[model samples]
Target: MSVRHDWYQSESKVVITVLLKNATEKNYAVKIGPKQIHMTADGYELTLSLLHPIVVERSSHKAFPSKVEITLAKETGERWQSLEQKPILVAPTIQTKNWDRLLNEEEKAEEKDAKGEEALNQLFKKIYSSSSPEVQKAMNKSFSESGGTVLSTNWSEVSKEKVTVKPPEGTEFREWEK
Candidate 1:
């Protein structure tokens, strides 16, 4: 059986939505791990080797009449290229299929479908995930210290001085209440 699902990610969590009409809590089972997810519903089994590690203890899910939402807390605040890991190799010979290429193209299509804030966040994540350690550190420091008002990719500038909040032209920046 084939299972249909979709996934999206935030700065700290990855949310997977499985389309399973008529699904119930008692009829479905979801298992989440640091690097994988195994799910079975209505005799349909689906497994995914995650692109990155998650905090299993902090992850959770909920079932609805029309779908299931699984939320995985990321171990790191890095962006995921896809929900599943890329295949390393394919069957050899003339009959060999380019499964990896096909999968990559599909993933690209999914990424392209993202819109608005989600699309922007995904772009930032992709940049951060592929950047150097110094750049990542700069981004984290600047973004955090500036109350999410700034994001700097230049390590030389970010590392040399502290980042200060720069709110919007008409907005005032305030610190979070503890």
Candidate 2:
């Protein structure tokens, strides 16, 4: 299906807004890379190969009731002639990201702010949606049995035994009496 979107840019950042009617966090997934973006929601998919490289670690996105807004930090302040670059004929099997790039003061400060539980939940949903049936089963079984503390994608291991609760360090696991 077709995706409706609009984009605008400043010297250092580009913002893309994808219009998705009645879009919720459960129904959408957005993956951003240094030079590409992939968004899928409610049977619609939008992929963009950016005209210029971006600082992947500095990019951010937010979802509203009607749309998703993506903000990408440009590698340099130079203006981009267009949003999308020409499509490359061959797609690379592996793309490497340089996470060790020196962060500026602002980026370093932003890193201190935790993304919180909502982002973690969204990540798990994305993984569950994209995984195979066996993996999904394992995840569901393990998560349910372990009091939501464990999630495993390995069907062979999870199927062999019932997953026991293993709480975080310094925390004890307990079963409540009926």
lDDT leader: 1
Model 2 alpha-carbon miss at residue 121, Å? 93
lDDT of 1 by residue, 1-178 (tens): 7589999999999999988876784389999989999989777878989989999999998988888899999999999989889867976667767999999999888777765569798899999999999999999999988989999999899988889989999999877799
TM-score for each prediction? 0.49, 0.47
What tens-digit string does per-residue lDDT give for candidate 2 at 1-178?
Answer: 9689999999999999999876674488889998899998878999999999999999998888888899999999999989999776886687675556545555766655445555787899999999999999999999999998898999999999899998999999888889
lDDT value for candidate 1? 0.90
List clashing residue pairs in candidate 2.
none
lDDT of 1 at 7: 95
Instruction: Give the Å shift of residue 38 in candidate 1.
Output: 0.7
lDDT of 1 at 177: 93
Q: If candidate 2 were superposed on the true structure by all CA atoms, what would the RMSD be?
A: 29.1
| Prediction 2 global C-alpha lDDT | 0.89
* Residue 144, candidate 2: alpha-carbon lDDT: 96
Compared with the true structure, model 1 gives a TM-score of 0.49
What's model 2's TM-score? 0.47
